[model samples]
Target: MMRRLLWFSLLVGLLLVVMPAAAQTTSTTAQVPEAVEITVGDEVEGALTEAAPSAEYALQGAGGMLINISLISEDFDSYLSVRDDAGTIVAFNDDSNGERNSRIVGLAVPEGAVYTIVAESYGQYIGSAAQTGDYTLSVSEAQVLRIEYTQTVEGELTSDAFSLDYIFTGSSGDTVVINEGSDDFDSYLRLLDASGAELFSNDDSGGSLDSQIGPFVLPSTGSYTIRAGSLSGEATGNFTLSLNRIESQAIAYGDSVEVEFTNNAREHYFTFTGAYGDIVTITADSSRTVDTDLTLNDPYNSQVMFDEDGGSGFDPEIDSASLFADGTFTVILRAVDSANGTVVVTLDRVPPQSLDEGSQIAGFSSSRTQIPMLFTGVAGEKVRLTLTSPSGNTSSSLNLDVRQDGTSIAYANANTLSAITVEFTVPNDGDVNLLISEYSYTNFQFEVTLERVG
Candidate 1:
């Protein structure tokens, strides 16, 4: 047992994450069979020596109770290890919140039982003669945070204790949205049932590297746990946690709703009723300077279709999309890349633009605002697509992308009315897309012509 304690003490610096605490300490020069008697809230002074290298104190508590243990010393770096009746280490700490003093917060005992608290110098057992020190050991009940729906709270995560849990109660059929935002660290969040089963988890849905879960509908009426933490275990900082109960907004066909993007990574959800196999045209249009994105989800919260830039000038449009199920569908609007701003999303009854031989469409283009046109092509068919700006004297540069399905097959560029001429043999017998955009941020008027060559 003495050799084991020394070996484990050597590992304190290497295993910084979570390892069973080891060691003990005593004021007496000789070792004792039973540990010194101590109780919660009582400050006991003890010293580590070569003869009596460690000491253990017994703690008795009820089931599911959480406790905080601390070992503060002026002599040397202190370490604390907690063990159950079976002598198995359950919790341990060498430092708390980046401090040298040892402390463990929110340590919960699943069942009512007695445990042993071991105290010693950081490297005392490993023969570091400088580890001899006097430490004040204390224990106290842990604090539990209770959250209410629609309420927000400020929280912090230290390097030692990087995660915190908050409890809340919700009724069945309620939709809840949880947001954990932090500028200091990337946030990660999880919701667990009373039995500690994780129902949902999220990372980076609450916009700009924040974590969000929901509009998640509650499965039953009961208390729930929200574990607020960071995306990286080493990340430590302050954060804002919010619990919001939301109602799905309703939208109808032919309705145009303007959404103001609050962040670069946001999920703005809306609902609409759809009939079986009904084709709908949905478009999310923003300023010609920004790119927009959107997704269609079925009632089950499963995505049906997504579009990033299918609309005119860097907008996302799901044109003539046939619904497979008849129910309330969800539409989530988002910003593409760094394009965060306002967008007008409309659900209209229209047909997808399909260009044929000799067909031409005139449009405007700007940097990051690309205009995409659809065309049908047969396999091995030779075709030429040309984009001319003004009277061959347009400002800014234009680029052309020939894509089969969603993958770009060819690329070309031009500066003025000097048309971007790219001729290629059709790789497949399907729909081909031509995306035209300006390389320079300036806006330019352009006309795209598609002609099949014999």
Candidate 2:
């Protein structure tokens, strides 16, 4: 039988009160026997020597319980490791608590297994000839928290600056929102990875004095931290912290989004990929009782267009032309005030197309807006224009015109249940504009065909 000697060092503190050491056990066949029983809120003091490099304790708790273990030592660097009864390593920590101390905080233990926690010195990494020292080991239970809860924290700022941290576990492609807007202080927010690297930061992004940091799509799966603080670095007061998971709909052309705006002021985002010279149009229709607003942003997050009542009545529309680049565009739908209603939004693209002589174009005239078409003609060429409204629908009527260099060449109008055609000869070789103006507002389809004639 090999006798293992246990050592001890002293640290005077409330949570660091010393306790007697447990019997040391050596693994005979890679299986350590008779671990010390350490329950929650218990602190055990022991020493490690180069001869006996590590100490083990048995952690007993229910599944889903948050187990926190810390190794605090001022004499030597501390390190920790956790393993199950099968000798399989479950978790480990080194230098995570700062100042060379070791800590494994908020580790969830599953059911049906006894966990062994080992604490020792960081041998070669510490670069010290004396590899043994005393450490105060503490095992405590923490409250398990959900991700979507709103917490109100009242704190004052110190010279070191005041900030609060909340842990969140997320997978790839998940969008998380952190909001700290329900207070009077100017708020700031930052999203960080496990290593404390900033992924995204924002100050005053939630509008006014509030702060918001997402709809941020996580790029990887792991533990992330959201930090909330004051933008002034010294402001203090009561504030509300809200952490939540949000779902955004994938949207593009020909798709409509059903939206409702509560009194809390909500905004919805949509994405569209476009190219230079492409004209993208977004229209919103709301109930007569609700007034809506629309905003389009380029890939660079620059505002492309914003409309409060550009559409007929209180509806909103955005017609963007000559996009500067090719990438995904973002559309934000909002309400003019606190209102709840359904809004049907549509995305329309008008890419550049050639319309030479004898070319025809078809489109819908239900928007009660002007539709413009471009065509080319040679000098001394005679072109024919036609506008045919939907027959059997008496509500359909439209006016058409041909123009060059802001000068009109020919014009025609069709009343309800009628059609119009006009012919004209071109004086120069260039592009001609065909304009369609709505004579009456109704749901109908109209077509225009062009032909060259002597």
Pick the TM-score winner.
1
Candidate 2, pairs of clashing residues: none
- For all candidates, what are the clash counts? 6, 0
User: What residue runs in model 1 are displaced by over 4 Å at the alpha carbon?
Assistant: 1-33, 62-64, 121-130, 155-165, 171-176, 184-209, 213-221, 227-238, 245-454
C-alpha TM-score for every candidate:
0.46, 0.41
**Number of clashing pairs, model 1?**
6
Candidate 2, residues 397-454: lDDT per residue as tens digits? 5777677655677887766655667999887788776666664645565666777788
Per-residue lDDT of model 1, residues 303-372, tens digit only: 5566777678778887555554678887777666675677787886544345764556545433134555
Error of 1 at 317 (Å): 9.0
Say what the RMSD of model 2 is: 21.5
Clash-forming residue pairs, model 1: 24-54, 24-55, 25-54, 25-55, 63-112, 392-417
Model 2: runs farther than 4 Å from truth? 1-34, 62-64, 124-130, 145-240, 243-250, 254-262, 269-454
